[model samples]
Target: MACSNLGHTGVTYTGKEDLRETLYELCQSPTITSPTGGDNVAGYIDGTEFKFYKSDNLARPAVVNALLGKAKSNYATVYTNRADALWIKHYPKMKVKLMDQLKPTEGDGAVGVTLALQTVKKWPRQIAAIALKAPIPGGGLHAAAAGLSKDLDLPPGSRKKGLARALRYYMLATYSLVDISSAEAYEGLKNYVGALLVSDQGQILAAGINTGSFRHAEVSMLLSYFRNNPTATKVPENSVIFSTLTPCKGCTGFLSVTKSSNCVIYFGQEDTGKDGKVGKKISTQLSEKTKAPVGRSKEKLPGEIVPDDTEDTEGTGVVAMGTASEIHKVQVDKGLTSCMGTGSIATQIGKAKHAKEVLRSGSEALIHKMLRTRATDAESEVKHAVLTHIGQWLGTSRSVE
Candidate 1:
């Protein structure tokens, strides 16, 4: 949620102090004097005081605020109260034509792909919020992504190029750099992207440039830029900071499996030697910590926001086999797994929660069974009633199974 400082009527008052100061300033403003001299001076002063008092009372900050109401408006109207209100002026909307072009035909795979493309192409600004990954929507964003491979006439392992193209378009759209349909802009886009991808500045460039030719000096230049500002090899935990050389045990088997056999520990900015540190022999997993200040130990306790989304067992890495803390670590690690592990989000969502609710309802293993099963009229009515009840509790209109 974005916060704003000013209110309507172009007033600069935010709260108590600003309101008082504004009122004081208004009071000290130039006063009108009587043209008729001495006799009318007192009357003029009285009239001025009355007018000032009336205006102050009528436009009192509390009253002005009460009339304004909570903003509760759409994104377009959201940032009007901020000090730098004009910054919101440049925000672009989803291109209506591009969106119309993506309208689904019978809602099949092509439609899905078109929708994904349209979505990414239009509001590329949203990509960061959703995380900088492929915008594969329902039925898999990758399914349509293959179209790029076919369109480019590339062979296997050419998916990355298509992915890169999509990413380039996405970045440009997000920054409002240029319109995608312009041919010259697209060509420039190609060169710019080529430069960024193989450059040391890019994370994927290091692993991807083995096959491409070296004619493009832009690629090498980018590689040099990345080398200078090398991407961090280690991502910090969300909530907690891992102190150097701390013997933090793995919470679960998955925690142990997620890390490489050798872990690299950096203290401040420098990597120091910790004799016989766990990273030297075996991989050590660190649980996420709060964003500092919460625990104050630099080490956050378990349950900090995991960097990765929990999806399923397949890519869940190995579960740690140790004490309760180890098991807890595994549990936390599972939360870091991606949601794209399996076919259905419902199933994957359950796995993300460790199948706990599913097991409690005896619905974990029964997912397939429930899908295959049919309902009688009476059962349907009862299910509808139950769904309604649950929906009321959840403040949703979701159908119950």
Candidate 2:
């Protein structure tokens, strides 16, 4: 479904395990001789003279593959086995120069490099600036549209430029599927401050897609945000599986992941205004929209704040434990009638599905096919569709609030 258009470059998954191994070796090497050097240096590694190129040249693709899957081979009918081969081939000439540009900085002049630090300083401020500078809360959609517009460096009069600005605010506001309080307040601040200005006509859809593509560019923008929080590498038993669609610039599809099952930390979006006015509202949007019988029941259980008793075998830990039962409950809550129904149904497309046919016969193919098709729709629809499909699978009616 046009993964590239959706900002899914597919390069992120190209033999990630192998690429990781190579990166590990590079890290151990003496290539990173100086954190603040512009000169090229060479040393022998395993008796071979090795040239130290840029750190990103060696690391960026690996990181990309870790997030996305693998890329398809363009020059050949057969798929490429090595992900690094592409970088080694087309990118070899550019690596040295790109690395030089990304080299460690000596002072405040470091500017574009050290993105993690740059993002830390910039993101919060950006949020505040939007909030404080605008004319109205939710009315300052243009400010959001313009700010993201600048971030993307979108060309003047380009469709993507307008979309970027709108999406920035839209994401913040829509984070709560059921409510728009925080987002509306942030938008309102921008309008109230008279700091926000927009010349572009309504072109948010195009801008959103472009912003989604920037997900790769601004990878470091969210580093601090993600780093501070922990996520489960594997699915958790207490994990509540909720599916939703988030439109980042271009890519929007079903993101079925778990929020903390026990303690749902609903940190409102960061304050972007200059006055430090952060959270203005606490809406139960996520809880209400993704609410299922399972989540409700779990939330009903008393929070584990009681004093610890060593003899209590069925302690809070046990209650919070992620087990098959919990996962099953979540899956059921998603509206799947059976365990297999929870997965995408596209993979099983074009196969026989009738009363006489066994559900498992071509289920995998059918589900994958369905997922491929659904991934291409608008982000909002994709989200709603996933919820609807999940609900249907669980034998729930389509009229869910």
Candidate 3:
């Protein structure tokens, strides 16, 4: 596939297969303070972090990131982050939209197009405490989300149906990028996801990405972990599962059966047609709206400091809040940290002994097992902090209990 950026046609994709399916994900970022001293260029995927000198080299170091197949995902972050540094402004990359098309060839003429890169101008990432990707809401949030719990008044006429709908259902939203292929298998490098299961009070439960045996669906693997694992099974029924992409009907049904109230998908709705345009279009619209973080808008609820409705917009990345250690605790460090609400988070843990064995045995199939363990911890640390802050914010902002 030919990739053209800024209207400059350059670089044909050099790979065996082009991505057949449209991909999506949700990026729940912990708000980091802008680099304090200077241009401190760093990037992290999953738990691994990379530092770079040249902005262009940012993508080169991302070889360690598990979810990103090639250099592009990290590269996009670097490109956008560095651009923000240079401009002295925050510009967030909302999403990467891939479009495939056929162009003229010399002799064989028509070639099967595999992959093309498109940068969505409006999908922003924030230091989110509770980011539910295209998530299905739990009893409370689900009721709120379905416009069942309360009356929702949306702005009228060409206001973007998605933006209004999201605001009506939620106070916050974020996004992610994914690589989709025709084959329904994980090929070590593509068609996987990064997942985290977190409670409303901010504790890590289970986390995994589509790796090893998990090539096709992350939601299934996450559900399996929650159901089968001794520790995760105890997660509060009110807890929510976060996935980088939207879950299929089967997986969503499974989540429903498991009694887990919410499964927030970061990406798009599943496609109804064979061509897959409908879902992709909706994803694009939602991402576009989420690219810029909504602030002090007319959407704010009465007597609230922040808006009643929080949505994303295009072209703005976020800075994480909190201290360096606090940032790193959840940002990079693995394995549970700090009590959430009840202070008995330690008791909430699954079998720590069994977790150690998974790490020690260290087989190929068990790679994701260890990954799930550590990533779950890492995501929980940050998410808890984020949730804690959100809780505090809600307390201070809302007069009623």
Candidate 4:
């Protein structure tokens, strides 16, 4: 859960409301000369400067303390106050370069530098790439394995690189959990895909099966989680997604919507002879449809997203990356919620029960503790709704189907 934005300097001061006063004086100061090499810079606050310097361990900077509810110490701690929350750590020192420094010229109290900080932690880095070659539509297990092996850029070896590596990485990283889509669940759906959203560290952000024949499992989890969770900030940011079957039109199209830039490993390989990898095909088509002049209006096209109204047939088509004009015909069933709403907990395992207790107690180690425990299975729409509700509460989505 590392944030990709950060090396930015921060503001420091004695207390709350003090930072503002300090900034006001700093801005109005004639000591810091206004920018020159121009004709006429007519304004009380024409330009400003921002400098990044190593922070002191003495006390929490006013800005930092206010943002992060930590002790009044700016010193970096090894742990975090909020569980499942990503925090920032500042770098020691670096050369400070003022890039296009400017300030507002409004009437009263218009001060402070228009600035942003860069991170020393270059995030969004690829940690691992897993390729799953499970049986999928239009391809069998053998076809997928061969295709995946041939398409993979790994050194020549067996077809288990992604799978084995993922498992081993999971074992090595103990702060992990594995969510499983139980075989006993979601019996009504047919020709639907299933996936386990695993991180290298055994954490399972989601275990989901497709809502029905048309909706992809990945799409189901993403939409449900993102829509329900009020703050869509916490998520599996940099981990790769490993799916048993090759991604189809529905699931592949969701990459952009989910903000999913991580490496995606699925079972199907391109025909190689002609069809190309499924990833490549989808990327090409999506690119063609989504291309537009930069800086153009940000208005979304008709089909760019699966409409919020799942009841409307118009929104039930393929949602390509940024483009969504072309409508693919699809069969719709009664909405997912109404279909799978009958489950009740049969026999709750102690550990899973305890995890729920921790959830109730509001422990920060929510997902980590839940992953280690086991739970009994019960199939009903009610059960599914309850699990989905818990997953959202934990900042993710979960469902039997």
Candidate 5:
């Protein structure tokens, strides 16, 4: 195998070798599974030589020792997360460089992994195509603002503004991932929807996307949150969840059972069944079941209100002012969300076709629009927040110098 050096410190140029297969093998190997009873493994690739490491957890000494002892210079390491995504970390410094989720190409289980690997290996050059800088249609910022204003026709207030801002972030994150998926030639990129669990303070707790499987976007987001914060059993109170498309029945049920968020907001309504009616009904029922907090007045008093320092927002799933959380359905014009939801049925039909090209073009266009769009202080803040949330998955710092 010919390996080209990209002239960058931590970037590994493995000429035309799709390492997803090797990653899947290591993940399923007995060494990693026997010790941890889980399919978690790590691999280091130097030249044509591949070294596999097994660890029960991220901090396992055996894997660390393998990396420290064996890896010397110019190598790439890959690891599998709880979400079955393959993350490539450049070695020597050990910073995550890239990642791709293993799709069920052939069948549901391990067979899918095999088929996906084979598919990637077969079209290495195509998968390695460079991203094109394309123009976005309808003007990125203008379209986004117009969509939010028209869709979420709520009384002008902070809540409406906040929801609109969060939706922008969600759309950006979703399109960004789609761009990556397109670069990697992942099938069904158009059907991808992004989900975010955000705190009342506007910090993103966890970010997730639909894997085109049983794990919907909402479910994946919750899983990522719990994986990152193992001690957290449920979502924090006053936290909101934003989904690019309205969740299905399965996702709504999971969110309700888990008490996933105080408020659930969605951009595009799903065409299946009653649009967002089911989710709204379920969320309303949950909110009604929740009792008002004691000692806090449900109605606002006419006097100057002092912030309560002792108020618990941890596990109570209550909103401020002793009110229950609500579900909001934004009515977006035919836009990015609709584009994303298309070809989902095709994805379900044995991957017969995908919307990768459409999604990639759309994503690039949106990105271009965003770049050309004038940036307000608030827009800058939202962009920074989105970058920070994505940075959690893609490491923030470069590999150790």
Candidate 6:
């Protein structure tokens, strides 16, 4: 894995914590002084290092072109906290020209800068947009979680348990962001998985979702980890990874190659997809090879408690409470209904309908049908469950107004 090398004025930050703090500081800094006028800042990650450009405005095409002139690869990711309208108008043209310059055989090279525009004052509106797209009952819950990202404080002495619950919440929240209709149409809701990588101390290293054809959730998470860490060659030992679904064969291979953590926990079993069958067998093989504990939690309904004397089953990798001895009781919110199996009932129905549509009229018709009949109620309940669990772990109460 090629990690990004951080560089700003010849200063380099080593380690993941340092990189995160430096990035946060850079984002908050007001003294950099943009040459063109406002507090706007623009930078690009060119596979290797991040280069910041100071300008009164967002980086113009000329500036970006100049930066690309000396770049080894055509791919890069541009980050800017400038006016949104400007990027909205400029991004298409920039993408077109950049694509024209891309090499057909460009393997593992920066493809082109994908613009990540963040406006300081429009965060509320951004949150609102996410809420609007979310299921009705979950809109407020999503907004609340979005607002509380910076205020996450795990209770003392229960940090590990809190972190495990937090990872589950993170996984669910990420999964909720998937466009269910599109997923049902093309694949299935069950296939749209999410993954999280956390350090031994409970720091979230990275998160990834399986949205595209090529990038599995685990592989996507590792790629994100490398991008953020920049210096890390492998996942830290004793680190824990949580995934919404079992790791498929490709993801297992990638995890093995990356020397990912031994402890992997999944919420859902493998589904009936092309790569799904490879999950358990490949994971068992990997476990045998690495001599690590690869396990899945036994199926339990919401609020169900495991017996104190329950022990982890050998070789099968069955564990009651993942990476923890004691499990904290999560308080379920009022008026929320529980759905059995891996995900919500809406997801299960969506998956069944998708399969039916696939057999009857192919994916296009399935997509059309899913778009027509949206499963908002069940989806909202799922989101509420995630928010409730997260709030319980953080020693707080959360609910949608």
**TM-score, every prediction:** 0.15, 0.18, 0.27, 0.26, 0.38, 0.33
Clash count for each candidate, listed in order shown: 25, 61, 41, 27, 1, 7
**Best of the two (3, 5) by TM-score:** 5
Candidate 1 regions off by >4 Å?
A: 1-10, 17-401
* Model 4: residues with Cα > 4 Å off, grouped in runs: 1-164, 167-189, 227-229, 233-235, 268-401
> What is the C-alpha local distance difference test score of each model?
0.20, 0.22, 0.27, 0.27, 0.38, 0.35
Question: Which one is best on lDDT?
Answer: 5
Model 6 agreement with the true structure over 202-313: per-residue lDDT tens digits: 3445556554433456655665665445466577665556554557655665665464445444433334466556666433211111111111123231222333234312
Backbone clash tally (model 3): 41
Residue 294 in model 2: lDDT: 26
Name the lDDT of candidate 5.
0.38
Give the candidate order by descending TM-score.
5, 6, 3, 4, 2, 1
Candidate 2 residue-wise lDDT, 222-336, digit = tens: 2212222223221222211111121111111101121122311121122233211211121111222222122222222322322222232221122222222333243221221
* Candidate 2 residue runs with Cα over 4 Å from true position: 1-224, 227-401
Q: At residue 46, give the lDDT of candidate 6.
A: 44
Error of 4 at 80 (Å): 41
Q: Candidate 4 overall Cα lDDT vs. reference? A: 0.27
lDDT, model 3, position 247: 44
Regarding lDDT, does 1 or 6 come out ahead?
Answer: 6
RMSD of each: 27.9, 22.2, 23.5, 20.4, 19.4, 19.6
Best prediction by TM-score? 5
Model 3 score (lDDT): 0.27
Question: Is 1 or 3 the stronger prediction by TM-score?
Answer: 3
Model 4, 261-351: lDDT tens digits are: 5433432112122212544543321111111111112333332332333332211222222221111101000111122232311111111
